[model samples]
Target: MARHNPSAPPESVISIIAPGMQIVGDCQTEGTLRVEGSVEGSIFAGKAVVVGEAGRVIGDITTQDAVISGRVAGNLVIGSRLELQSTSVVEGEVHARRIQVEEGTLLNGSVHIGETDGSTLTHEGQSDSEEQQLPIDAGSWHRPVVAAPKR
Candidate 1:
C-alpha cells in the first residue's frame, strides 16, 4: 500500500476499520486511523482519520485530515481536508481546509473550512503490540504516531 502523506490535505489519508472490533473512549494519534467498529468518545489525530462503512463514532474529532464512510455524531476539526464517502453518515460540525462529499452520504451539522492560528500537532500513548499483550480490559491506551524532531 502507498504511504499516506501526513502533510497532504486531510482528505488524502487512507485508513480502514476492520469489521467486528469496538472501541470506547477518547482517541488521539498522528498519521492515520480507520474505524470499522464502534467508537464512543472523542478522537484527536495530527494527520488524518477515516471512519469505515460499518464504523460509528459518538464524540468530537480533531485532525488535520478526515474521511467518513460510516456514522459519526460529534464535532470535527480538519486542518486540511475532509471527505465523506458514499456510505458515510455524519451528524455534527466539521471544520476543515477542504471538504468533499460523495453521492449518497448524509451530513447533519455545521462546517468550517480554512486556516486557523496557533495549531500545533502532537501524538501520545503506547503501541498496539503492547496493548495486545495485556488483558482485553486492562485500560491501556495506544501511543500516538509522531515524527522525529529535526536534527
Candidate 2:
C-alpha cells in the first residue's frame, strides 16, 4: 500500500539558457536560472542565478544570490550573496551583502557591500580612478556548471 501527500510543495525549477541561444529582452523568474549562452537584457531572478563559463550577460542582474563564471558587462544587485569563479569577468558595479570571489577573476568596476537602502549600487569613484577589487579566498574555489547539449 502507498500513501500520497497533496500538500507538498513543488520542486524549484531551474531555467536554462542553452548554448548557441540568445535572449534580447528582460528576463524575470521566480526560481533558479542557469545561463549558458548570451543575454542582451537584464535578468531578475527570485532565487539564485548561475552563469556558466561560456555565458555572457550584457545587462544588469538583480537576484537574491548569484554564482558567476562567465562575463557580465553590467551592474549586479544581489540581495544576499554572490560568488564569482576564477574564470569570471565583470565590467560593472556590484552590490551585495556577502561576496566571494575566486582567484584569476577580472573586475573593472566598483563594489559596495552592506546596506543598499533599496537602491542599486552606483559607481562612486571618479572616471580616472575606477575602483577594482577581487577578494578571492585562497582556500575555496567554485567550478562552473558545464551543460551537455541535448541529443
lDDT: which candidate is best?
A: 2
Q: Model 1: per-residue lDDT, tens digit, 1-151? A: 2356667775455454467867777876545778878777777776778787888787776777778888777767677789999887776566677899898876665666665443543332221111211122112122221222334
Give the TM-score of each candidate. 0.65, 0.71
* Model 1 alpha-carbon miss at residue 105, Å: 1.6
Residue 64 lDDT, candidate 2, scale 0-100: 78
lDDT of each: 0.65, 0.73
Candidate 1 deviant stretches above 4 angstroms: 1-17, 117-151
Q: Report lDDT (Cα) of residue 84, candidate 2.
A: 91
Instruction: List clashing residue pairs in candidate 2.
Output: none
lDDT of candidate 2 over 92-125, digit per residue (tens): 6788889998988877667888767555432231
**Model 2 alpha-carbon drift over 4 Å, by segment:** 1-11, 118-151
**Counted clashes in each candidate structure:** 7, 0
> What does each candidate score in C-alpha RMSD?
13.2, 12.2
